[model samples]
Target: MFYGDKLTELRELNGLSRKDLADKLSVSEQAVWQYESDKVTPRIDVLNALRDLMEVDTSFLFEPNMVTRGVASEGHIAYRADDRKSRKKTRTELTYLRYVEAFVDYFEGFLTQEERSIDSLRSMTKQQADKIQYAGSQREQNLEIENLAEVSRNYLGIQSNRDLMYKIENSGVCVVERNLGQEIDAYSTISKSGRSYIVLGTHKKSAVCRNFDIAHELGHLLMHQHQNIELLTNEEYKEIELQANRFAGAFLLPGAEFACGFATLARKSNPDYYVDLKSQYLVSIAAMGHRAYDLGLLDYQEYRYFSGRMNTLHYRKLEPLDDKIVPIRPGKLRALMEFVLKSRLTSVDHIRSLFHVRPQFLINLFGIDQHFFDQFEHEKHSYYGGAKVIRMPGA
Candidate 1:
């Protein structure tokens, strides 16, 4: 029997309304509702059309529901967007995240694998969460954020800011670039199962900006983990966002080092001078100026002048060297898949079959390029250890 819940999952994951899917299937809106309500099954043609339209096998509609429990509520998700997304958009994003988590769950079955970086990272995050101690006052909270930033840096074991992205990935956070629309820069959420995920916007094309975005979301994961942000007033939400921003600034540019570096700059107010520091810190000039102001290295007048000069130079929108530093894409998922395939633990066809989805659908979930899947289209391998074994003559 066809399961309506699975259809509902796919429809919502596609961000489509019943009417949208109905029109695609050349059927009435009510017909689509009935199919999803289990009031009626789709006709053969409709099933085939739905299969083609959704890029999933028709048999997938008959499989058990893929919904996973303990998904973070939309309100629980920490977003770094300029404006709040609509409920529909948030639902779609969370739905997509749940599916990604589900896929990771299935993928990890082959490894028994904490030797898998993600697994070890998850364990570390849990331990760190227990040690977090929230402060009572606003001033204390600010101090706490600074402390956490330093703690996070120590946790990642990086000596320099340059390897921030690499350290974050190794820490077991799933970071991926997806088109999160114009307003939203990034978001992070932790599942009940202890999986941490950060989704970065494709609009943030600058490497320095991406670094800050990642750090901002990391602040959310570490600091705002338990807050019911959806229940907070507008003012309260803004406060947390400010805290995350402070955390990002401190995390990317540690206080002592940043102070020492800023001391070396001859013209603290000149944006041009900060450009020299940008290459070393991989931080935008504007961000460096803010850091300088925060650290009291730049007085009010100097900081004001730096801000004005940034706007004058158009550095506010597009900073110098923004084009030179290429942004880093999230690599843990891709790396895990490569290890699995090269180890001959699983074949691409097996994964595709397990998900009952086309390569394009998998591409959306994995945040990987289509060519990666294209390369494996014709490849086949005999399953080893799990079900079948391939004998090597030399062995």
Candidate 2:
């Protein structure tokens, strides 16, 4: 029997209405609706056309489990883009997220389960919810956020700025890097099984900016999990963003440590003085300036003067050492794929067939190159060695 819901999901994922699909299939709109409603199944030719149109195998329409396991409603995606025109781009990203979930599900099946305890966003939220609820004033809320950041840092054992990505991955959060278009900086979502995913934009060249993006998304995962972001009002969304920004700031630069460092600055209002702090904290100069103001080291007037000077120097667009620091790239997923292939537990072809997606889709989603999948062909190349060829006695 054909699955109607699966067909409908595919059509919507492709941004096609019934009429659009019908036109592509050279059939009546009602016929397309009937097929999606399970009143009638598509013919062989129509199935082929759908397979081509959707870029999926024909069996995917009949076997829903072959593609995705859950509905989009089961997940909560928080996009970083604020423009209304990015709705289509958001949908495309959601599709990519679904595929990511599928890949994680399939890849984890081959690994042995361990009993190690790891702190996750959900667990932390439950532990801290009451404190957040009872907080009356904005000052109390800020204090709570700072406390949460301190607890989170200690929980993850992040002693310094080095190897931050590894600590996040070890905490069971799936971090992925991809080209999320120019508009989107990053996003976070929680799966039905409560798996956390944070996707970083590949367009960001500065490691400091990417680190801030990760920390911001981490804030969303810890504070706003399971919230339907699409239904949130503009004001509500802005408040949520503000909370995340505060979380990121405190998490990256703790109040006591950062304030002590700022007190050593010779010129509090000079942007150049922050270059050393930026290198020490692996955070941007602008962020460090804001942190100083937030920590009360710089008064409002001083912060304004600093901000105006920064704008005049054009430091906000591209700061010092932005080109020097190497951006941290995600590799946990790639390592899993390599282990599976090297151990002969599975092949690339089998994985692609299971997802019913193209190789380029996997390449782009996992941040790997074509050479990763072509390792077998590369191994076939023979190198000429200066050695005497000896014939065996039997030959």
Candidate 3:
């Protein structure tokens, strides 16, 4: 079992698919799978290759265990589950979560091995984790999504939205969905540890909902990054949720900054016009309600009026609904895959082989199907024209 559990974690941090990792190591992915499962061990040469490929000290692969000394939570339990479940069970919905944990393990290793500055990387990691989970900053209470995203970029070193999403997952934040039927809201894991993850609605949702859910999850990631590893009751969850909500607000709407935009409009119009607010800010009606009330931009009466208006907007007889479902935009992962393809870092054919999917997956994911791909072929394109399913990130 040498490096059995560690290999998958390293692979995820490097953002390598199993196939890509296999290619680098000259082994079949199934063989790699066997190694992670402890069914067989990697050769000494393979361990050396892994160390180099992942740019880590060999000592990382020999970490004693996931010994959690603090309070227990879902994340702690999940990681400390039967090693088979944690390292080898790769077919469940939580596969994405596993990838996230692996990334965290990798990043933690990278930081810990640097100059040996970690007096207690575990405590450092835990503190950051607590801030992400509980401590709500003044800045967070009034931010908008862009503001929040920017803070995340600077503090957490998010290079791009794709990177941000990857980190959120890698940090082991749990996302759960509360199906509102017409709408869905997201919940972050009550307890998170090494990996940050968020509980959000399914992918088969609308863009607006997805955006909100992402923002919501992002709130959980930032506010709860390092708080409690112990279990919490529903009341604790609510309290944390409120803090996250404030954090989300401030991240999305900077009170002073965005107020300037509203103040200018206040001269010419009323802030209570919910439609006007939504269009101008590109936020939802509900969001506008919270933002307006928090900032004293709208009184309780006016805000209530705006709330009523939201119900009417939901079913107004506008243009007939289109037959085609508006597909949610392909997110950051898809964007990176295209970048990798365009950059020639990897080939489309190779990606296809790695994903074990037909090419149409790529076409549909990148929206290559509805339009004529051949026209763009001669000029330049990131993916294949053949309408075959392609490899999803974790797949």
- The estimated TM-scores of all candidates read 0.86, 0.79, 0.46
Q: After superposition, how far is residue 300 of candidate 2 from its true place, in Å?
A: 0.9
Query: What Cα-based lDDT does every candidate model obtain?
Result: 0.77, 0.75, 0.45
| Residue runs of model 2 more than 4 Å from their true location after superposition | 1-65, 69-75, 84-90, 115-121, 376-395
* Tens digits of per-residue lDDT for model 2, 80-113: 6656345556555666667788787676666663
**Model 3 — which ten-residue stretch has the worst lDDT?**
110-119
Candidate 3 structure quality by residue, lDDT tens digits, 72-155: 244322111112222232222233344334323322331222221111322334444454434376444333333444455455
Clash number for candidate 3: 47
TM-score computed on alpha carbons, candidate 2: 0.79
Higher lDDT: candidate 1 or 3?
A: 1
- Estimate the Cα RMSD of every predicted model relative to the unseen true structure: 5.0, 8.1, 13.6
Residue 222 alpha-carbon offset, candidate 1, angstroms: 1.0
Q: Which stretches of candidate 3 lie over 4 Å from their true place?
A: 1-92, 99-208, 227-230, 264-272, 312-331, 342-395
Candidate 2, position 201, lDDT: 78
The residue pairs that clash in candidate 2, if any, are none
Report the error of model 1 at residue 392, Å: 19
